[model samples]
Target: MRSVQRVDKCLAAACLVISRHAKFCEGARAMRLLLVTPIYPPTRGGIQTLLYQLTASLPGTDVKVITAKERGWEAHDASSGQLIKRVWVPEVSPLIRNAMFNFAALGALYGWRPDVVLCGHIVASPASWMIAKRFKAAHVVYAYGREIGIRPALAAWALRRSNAAIAISAYTRGELLAAAHGATLPPIHVVSPGVNLPDDIGRCDASRPTVLTVARMRDWYKGHDRLLDALPLVIQEVPNVHWVVIGEGKIRAELERRAKAAALLGNVSFLGEVDEDVKESWLSCAHVFAMPSRYPEDEAGGEGFGIVYLEAGARGLPSVASNIGAPTEVVVDGKTGILVDADSPPAIAAALIRLLTDADYARKLGSAARRRVETGFTWELVGQQLHSVLDEVAIAQSGP
Candidate 1:
């Protein structure tokens, strides 16, 4: 009876404390968040998808987006049901476009004010930094490993001004630290990107071994070339092996030429930039997902977080990824997927053959991958993590 009375007293005291600072608590709960990003969908990229999903998941918060105007954005913005401001940026000159975007983003912050200003990409950070200062809001930057090293000076300057930095993976967090270059840095938090799980798990076709690679062939490090190099070896062991490549880039012609030189025209198909339904269908039907991405000579060019791997995992498809960079954190070697030397064609080929031949082993890994996504990698989890970070910073800045 005495213990129960003591608990009641403690609860009463907690309630009194909460009631005393109710307004502060309310502000924290209904945080006004503004995202300044270089691009948003219908632009179609991992970062764009991430910002959209993360914003959608945060129903309690008031969110607005400032991004460059792209084709089909009006329809996407209307369907999103979120307040979005599109800035006109010319496509001719990189310097002029970037400068215009920064100034336009600044001008867009007219009527409303946000409690937290998020720089969705480093290119937006300078404008975000100025906006945060002008509004007396907390500044946060999303750190993807590759971008930090691309423009080291700008990355450092933006990071130094930010109150906090959110890294998409542990590897990215390390890169953020390295990019600091001895300057005092903001607190870095790792928030790996999430995927929407399919309602039904995909089953692989036993008759034909099919490998799927979905990525823009923008850079050689994306490992589309490495996958091509490995395809011949895979065909030698499992003839009639089919490889489907999705996405479009200038490098597509070069990759096609390489395939023709090897006389792999029949085994390879390039489905350029398909619809969401089509991509999901491929994810469902394919036996394995492979993008053996590697670290290039320039440290700035590499995978920050492989969202497609999670998409495949969500569909109960095992992945073939490089044993380096961000994939090391996303994929569980020997359990969720196979990780191999990204630079070695033989290593990639061997991993593919092993999964293709042993259906039972592949299924085991795929099941584990699906379970991992269910337990940890969901948009709801990302929202919760983001909310916690926002609350912590808001409360700290609001100091009693």
Candidate 2:
């Protein structure tokens, strides 16, 4: 059984490599893809970023993105030469907003008549499936961690309806299979997120520990509070340890208040919504990247592959991520980085301490992590995998 599993993995990796090379090979035709995402560029989040990268990588493909235009965003324009369309919808009142946006998306998709519709996130899946059904177009759904957890009825319906489904991590794929309860749904493709590595690598010093986390200031899911709680313990072990958080969200002020209350304000700094250069700099300078994600009741948001882990790894920086959701796949325990129990302050702090004290060990993990991503997770690779999936769906749909 173990040998079979190993063979399967090896085959999958080889297929990925072959497919990637084929995409760059001569005489490759790009498929017209319609991406249905809840949010797109100008909207700040991992999913949005992933869609942006995927669209950018697929050359010669007529890519059209359908997304909601939240406040502070201008009306959509195809200025980038990509077919972009935005439907203005109310951000407030979830019920009405979803209904209106989905209806608008369906209308746009029917009129545009894309060869395939790729929906990002389960919430958008139902609408994408509906559009596909109405137009008899092929449909694929992208499931992140939270969408597959415990399997909500709507998510299940969406998955069952789509021609194929893509999960960001193995952890998420397992959860989705379990949710299906032995019932065959769609073909599940595990495509871990990718990150652009920096050209120059930085050195990690054991004496002056630098801990960094790049995530929105969302509540328990991002685990800002838990990181704050662990700070005191980390500071006790390494007095000069500094924790830097990048990105901003709704809970920014509240998290700041909590950090101040815990007397962690001095040790922690919040650098809100940093640009790519600054983010890469932070990842390079940091000795360890930590994120202790906790499952929230809503389950709409949770750690999904934690692309920041890959970003950190690319910079030759080891990480300490929580043992929850898709983070387990991104941070290889005792290999790429340390994985600790979720929401446990002491466990998180201890992991940080270990990484800070053991410079050689940390460097080894960082090197391995960087190699892992470079070998498997690259935008070119991801784009190739996606194109292959699209081709399969298109062929299957055109069957006699």
Candidate 3:
């Protein structure tokens, strides 16, 4: 059985090679790559997850990650073929942060002298640009929505200087291009964050009306307050509704207080900082996933792409997200999920109520949502896309 499975895997690889019209398996060869980010795993967030995924995906690639020791880099090593170097940066003050970041980045570049640098945050933009300029190495920047939208001048400079830039969603790409304002921008690509779909939605009852949202309890960008405000109306419409909130943040206390104030304490469950297994269980158990993220003052603090929506969708669960930033890209309006106007509590409430009340409609949307993720949003596919981008950049840089 094991031999047969191995044969099947080999055949699948052959088919992929043929389909892609490749002369050789480009991924088999090791390439020197540097990844810079603000955060990394054991620390929860999209950027951290993305960096880990990118590095882990490329097996033979010599990958190194440079990040600030904000919470202290844990669950990674510098000697496991994948190097993780943490620099102490005072995140509180801008002046100190910039100085520390520049010094640290320069030290990393000087020591490693990697072939390519893939920066994961805009805070590292200046350092990345300088390293690329000085060493003449290929630099690629990953632009999440908030970073690109907030630091327009820095983003523009990085976009112009970097060999290429990757946007997590089409919305982000559009915003980046708009910010550039006809300036010759680098080659930009959209590679949506991927989610691992569970084999079975364990112990979940589809008939029950359960709503899930996996977002930090932040008052501004995450819009948990708005969701809470909308809950009363939703409960009036679908009285049996239950909400599961899976995340931890500074605003958790405030949100809990608000839930009590709004008379939603009994209906809402706060499961703080759940692991992957627990998150999957909740995703499978829930009927719908909702996150109403809103942009905070046109700053780079909006949802670049709500990956939780896809995680829920992958489990044949529909989503109800705000029509803002990358959530608009993640959730297909009326198909995979509903997209309501940002900051409109009534609109959010109405959408959630509609999904809970209409069983058949919700099921259909969920089915479509699952199929969408299965088709294009898996980590395997995302890794392939990134591999191609890296190969192209490498080849271009090696040219006469």
Candidate 4:
């Protein structure tokens, strides 16, 4: 802690010097914004999607990305408007990859200096702060729930140094506050993720009432097991109900085995990691979207903001989600979707059954959800909010 304080003091002194010399000419030229993230598109994760959407949504802002190289990234970048620089780092070790990425980010800032630097993930936080400080640009850091929850000290350190911060949800904001541990922090804006309203994607098989869950099976907190447990009860009520699972991870084989053991093979289909169009099509046809994520026993991690719920909601599908975490904020209980105790298989089962059987009620909720997304959760709105924050921070950093 003492060491941290000393480092903070040193950085603070350096910042005082940089602010006087930092020249920000904003009116005539487009705002040059640099995004430093560990992962980018074709990686298929929430942060990647968020950064990608952010780039597309901000029209006048000149956006550039610095991220680690990923498979098929070149093809994806070829079609993009913004310049994306992929730093080649060995994928075998995360520590090496992150360390190399930071070093690369520091040296990579050669030709163009951005007016603002946004760190997409915590791994890039320090480098982002240094770069922003060097340019006298506004430094912004984003906080996601699990990352902060798992490493409060690190989160606190990053937040203290930033000019501003963005939290994906109120739940994530809470996590950031807790991480501060009574220490002062920068203005933390709660910017819930936005979803794209999909085109008329074709539908899935409607032979039976279908429930869909889209989440990586790598973590236990996503509550796939609980959903699997609820399936038997749901099957008892609606025997022909089909449960389609998307995403792939190490634990998928185990979840499949558990489903098989529970005699849910006939009812459940594990379509591991399908294309985006296919996932959207399932969302369009599925009667209910369910991924009842629960906090682990240690309470170290939970959903920051369940974007999948909004995605399903965008497709006019009512969700059955856990009553805890950011899902409560995303899925309005008894309004847009049914929220239940994720630990209680019966509760999950009941919600699923209720949505499946009562078409009128489900449709009402689904329609409301679609309307909610249309009004509040569109990417355009997200971009505007973010743009405002960036402008505010940049102006403040460039004092009169």
The best candidate in terms of TM-score = 1
Which structure is stronger by lDDT: 1 or 2?
Answer: 1
In model 3, where is the ten-residue run with the lowest total lDDT? 19-28
Candidate 4 residue-wise lDDT, 1-400, digit = tens: 9999999999997886555334433345677899998888979988889889977897568888888888998888898876988888886687777888898888777789888899998888888999999999889998878988777887888899999999999999988998898898899999889999877634454778999999988898898999898888988889899999999999899988898887889999999989986887788888889999998877686899999999999988899888988999899998899999999999999999999999999989998999899999999999988887887787678775
Write model 1 residue lDDT over 17-44, tens digit each, in one string.
5654454465654778999998789899
* lDDT at 324, model 2: 68
Model 2, position 218, has a per-residue lDDT of: 54
Candidate 3 local lDDT, 112-133, one digit each (tens): 6666788788778777767766
What TM-score should be assigned to candidate 2? 0.84
| lDDT, candidates in the order shown | 0.88, 0.78, 0.79, 0.87
Residue 390 of model 1, lDDT score: 72
Position 339, candidate 1: lDDT: 97
TM-score against truth, every candidate: 0.93, 0.84, 0.85, 0.92
Q: What shift in Å separates residue 271 of candidate 4 from its native position after superposition? A: 0.9
lDDT preference between candidates 2 and 4, better one? 4
lDDT of 1 at 128: 93
Which parts of model 2 have CA positions greater than 4 angstroms off? Answer: 1-29, 70-81, 109-112, 148-151, 202-208, 296-301
Clashing pairs in 2: none
How good is model 3 by TM-score?
0.85
Per-residue accuracy of model 2 over 1-400 as CA lDDT, tens digit each: 9999999999998876566445424576456688887777776688878888877776456688888876555633434556777787876787677777787887665456666888876777768887777767789988877756645676678878888988888877876777777777979898777877667776634335789988877555787777788888988888888888898888889888988887777788899998877887778788998887767776564676788888888888888887766787778898999988877889988998999888899889999999988988888788777777777776566443
